[model samples]
Target: MNDIRLYLFQSGSQLCKVHDIKMNQGCGQDMEIPVPWFLLMHPKGNVVIDGGLAAEGLADPRGYWGDAIDAYRPRMRPEQGCVAQLATLGLSPRDIRYVALSHLHCDHSGAVGRFPDAVHLVQRREYEYAFAPDWFAAGAYARKDFDRAGLRWQFLDGEAGQPFDLYGDGALQAVFTPGHTLGHQSFLVTLRNSGTMILAGDAVYTLDHWNETALPGLLASAVDAVRSVQKLRALAERSGATLVPGHDPEAWRRFRLAPGYYD
Candidate 1:
């Protein structure tokens, strides 16, 4: 049995009005981006990637954005959160055994509060950056949300290109592909029957960017970011894995969406 199934939970349909320079260059017709949350199921347990923005933060937009750029607004409501989406599949927060974070951006770590029991799998460097940030340069990540009591965690540390096996059997693996953040990582999942899928977090936000080899403006270092993208592209090609971007909507349209699941 190919007990693994991938689900797109939150479908954030918004036009990317900003450009690669982080300046308000007006809404270019070619700039719409899709922000998505993914859930992966295995016979052993369920694993969620990137928790999405919290409902509370969404309710008070000022709280989430502060003085950040508002050139683009999410078309989806934060209150219609990822947890609620998981509920639609008859799964609760407790069902998730592991929560794999691509990086600690507020949008990706917002729902961490919901899964108190799941062991958080993140890169050690990423966690450290989130805790003490250079707000003047790299901005901030929501580290306070992770201070919950008894929260279990697994940190990956080693050479940059090495891969971490989530299970000894090669069913799930985490590849360190830093650039978007110092310890940012991407996951490679092999289904019992569904083949391979690579969840390439913000390593490549859009396929267009990936295809063009263009780095996003928000990256800490453009040089490192491009190197990461090259690593991802090589991996996907060599392994024949379906690469899923962190915020690309076209990927949603190309996959089979479960009922009540966002496409």
Candidate 2:
């Protein structure tokens, strides 16, 4: 029997321009996309993959995100925050043993601090970049979301340390997939009956980005982005794993939500 259960949760939704998600495609078109976070319930310990948007945004988007709100407007509900979503399962931040972050973007790392007892696993380069990002990505990283002194962190260097198996088991893996950012990563969860799942963080934004029809918006490196997308695609195809894209509204609808889990 599979000892792992995966649950999906939406922290909120963001209304953004097509070009904002996919590089230079839909200019004036508006798209409302779901911001999702995940939890993996394993016999060993629980892990949170990305924490979704910060709960503070629900109170005041402009005040929390500053000028960045103009580009990707947030529409968050009270029950959609990370804490609230976990509450439905009778779980809390303290219950999580580890937080495997894909990157340090404000949306992805917002609730990370709440898991004070959990070790925050991130790429070393990403850690450095988030604090001192270039002018182009200056608005994306909100330091306040993850800059707590007491929160614990576990850093992975490069490929050598990565595809890091959480709990020293083959069940959960942190796959280094840099491109969307300097230290971006993706995750792989293996279940006995439900098969394997590839959680493509921002590494592959949507099917358009996955299928190579369009590149993702705001690329740190176009070459790296393409390589990472193709790499993820190949991995999924080779292993017959379900590849879940980041910020895909259509994909989100198809997903089995919380209360319902994949074991």
Candidate 3:
């Protein structure tokens, strides 16, 4: 039996324009989607994947996120951050052994600093780009979230057969699937009885993108993004793994939330 377990936390939610979620669709409509984070427990160590919005935002959204809040306004409960969620299990940031970030976008990277003791895994290009993003790309990243002091970082460049297995055990693998943002990635987790699953971060915003029905509203490279979706979808099909979209309201509900887990 596998000793790995996965916990899904609903950190909070975000309100954005439908145009920002689906291309050429729902222009005037509003879309509210869950902001989620994952915790993986294995006999080897514990890991956190993009632990949602910062708890500070609950007190001061504008002060914390600044103008970025205008585009993706957030709504969060008090107990919905990395620290609070981990606390439920008698854990803390120091308890995390690794933090495998999909990318360093604001919403995704907000809780990074909390796990100072863990080795934070980031893509090399993603690290450089998020640090010095172009004018158009700057808003998506908030440096305060990641540019803190004394956090250990291990950079992964997209290499051939690029899924970097976390423990050399097929349990948690960070798959190189860029596109929505340069160096963006997805994850493949192998559960004992639940089977393998793909957590498609921004690389696949919703099922529409996975189905080729729509292009993501935000794309660093449309070509790269399209190829990524195809790659992830095909992998899921071949391996009989469930492909979870990054921010799909309807789809997100299908999963078992935290306080619950997939083992």
Candidate 4:
């Protein structure tokens, strides 16, 4: 039996012009991709990867999302909230011991407050960039979604290019794939029968993007972004891991969405 179980949940969908995600491709066309949040069941504790959209945002996008609401246009359902989805597995936020954030982007960290007791794990630089006075210089970090009070935050400071093993065992680790954002990171999870799976969190938006080394519409550093993809490709080749992309509707169809799981 596998020591860790992984569940991929569709928290919601974010619709944006295709060019917004991948530069120059489908310039005037719109595409909607599922917003995914993962639940990892570990022997030591349960972990939530990316909190998805806030529950309130589901009912009132304009109120919570503001101007970006018109840009990203997230389509959320009440049942997709972290709390409701966890219930399907006979769990709750309190059951989560750690909430791992790939980055503090609104789509990724909106529901972080739901797991008040879980220790929130984020790259130190990513956390700092989220709160920096000029954090919005690149324009995606939303203060309303993050910057919540009382949640236990644990900063992980790992050397660039080095993967941080969250558990002593090699079952789970954080791969530093900076780009897309200053401190964007991906995760590598090792399962028993399933082998290895790489969760490429916005570092590589889609398989097409990965294949062509395409840049996103909004990017901090194109050079760094391409480097991140190259690193991920090499890692995937090295480990023979299945790379779970961040926001690719077509790519997402290949997976079994929760309440199904990969163990």
Candidate 5:
């Protein structure tokens, strides 16, 4: 049997102008971007990547997101949280052995607290930046999502060229892809039947961004973003891996969701 399987879950969707995701274009165009998370089922353990909206955000947007709620209108339901979605797959937070966050953005790490037993992996800079006093001043990184006590935090050192092997069999690997955030990362999963798949977690919002080199609506460094895209492009081309974007509505529709999986 294949040692691992992958499932896609639609945690929530947000309404934002096209410019909010792709810079200098789609200024007046309104679109709904789908927020997705992945569940990697391995023989040894389960890995959760980029947990989406938590029950709190779906409960109260203004209370959780503040004034930014108007610009990035996040529409979520309590049932859409990671825990609830996992339950649909006959799993729960307790089943997850590791939670690898792409970045500490509010939308991505919202449900992290649900998996306190899992080893949370994040880049050193991303962890520090998320806790920096000025970090919350921008209101992008929500404290409630990550400040939970008793949660196991594991910092991944990119400077040492550490590519985290999720199951120690090289089926899943973490790829450093920083641009949208200072220390963001993507995932590369080598499946038995589906071949190689690179889950581009906000590294490239949509294929448009990957194709046209259009910078994301919000970026920490444009230069870094372009470089990251180039790296992912090269990796995909060389390995013939399918690139799974972070928040592309069109791309999201193509994936087979939980209960149904790619093995």
Candidate 6:
């Protein structure tokens, strides 16, 4: 039997309103939401889904983002550092064997430098976009941290239909669920005691978004995003796997949280 146990680590949480942006669901009003990033642990090994915004960026505004990053100042905080949270659980950065990123967004890839020894897994197309961003806007990718850490990287180049099995035993799988970004992906983790849990990265940011069939303002392609959500919802229904959204406030309350960890 696979003795797998899962842990939900709240690397960080942010409060933001929909009206903060120019696009407000076409209703000209704002909605309050809690944004959260998480980490998953298994008996076989620990895998960090997405690294939350780093403390450095939250501390000195002039250091990381001079003017372009000022828009997010109100919602970001240093108290939710992922590295520090890991220490609270008696697990160091070295304890993580794999760092599976949903995409290369600045918020999701902030603390990647914390785990230097782990193999950083990402889709090939996503890495390509991060390296050469001329096709889209520039500075969308943060490459400095990965370069600074001298971390080893692994690229998933499989076709969209087939899922990439990280452990080769069907215990942990990375599913290609692109939309918000070109190479965006989600993870389906099978636990021995808890069945299957699907980490729906930014593909489905919140359950409300899924229910309403609404797309976030920042999207590579709205059509693709909708399709990815349909696929995720179908998979979750067929497999009976608990779908965890990337930024759902109720995720911590609905699912089990790691001891001493708070959202």
TM-score of each: 0.86, 0.96, 0.97, 0.94, 0.95, 0.85
Summarize candidate 1's per-residue lDDT along 30-142 as a digit string, tens digits: 45666667787777777888876666666665566454425445566754577887887788889998888888876677567688578888899888777776764333464
**Candidate number achieving the greatest lDDT relative to the actual structure:** 3
Q: What is the lDDT for 77 in model 5?
A: 84
Candidate 4 ranges with C-alpha deviation above 4 Å: 133-139
Q: How many residue pairs of model 5 clash at the backbone?
A: 1
lDDT of 4 by residue, 187-218 (tens): 98888878899999889888876897468776
RMSD of each: 3.1, 1.2, 1.1, 1.7, 1.7, 3.3
| CA displacement after TM-score superposition, residue 147 of candidate 6 (Å) | 4.0
Worst 10 residues of 3 by lDDT: 157-166
Predicted structure 5: lDDT: 0.84
Q: Candidate 2 has what TM-score?
A: 0.96
| Local distance difference test, each candidate | 0.70, 0.87, 0.87, 0.82, 0.84, 0.69
List candidate 2 stretches off by more than 4 Å: none
Instruction: Report the lDDT tens digits of candidate 6 across residue range 43-113.
Output: 56777777766667766644664443533442654656777777777889888988888888766786577
Error of 4 at 153 (Å): 1.1
How far does residue 66 in candidate 1 sit from its true spot (Å)? 2.0
- Candidates in descending lDDT order: 3, 2, 5, 4, 1, 6
Error of 3 at 163 (Å): 1.2
Which residue pairs clash within candidate 4?
A: none
What tens-digit string does per-residue lDDT give for candidate 5 at 94-127? 8989898998988789658787579998888888
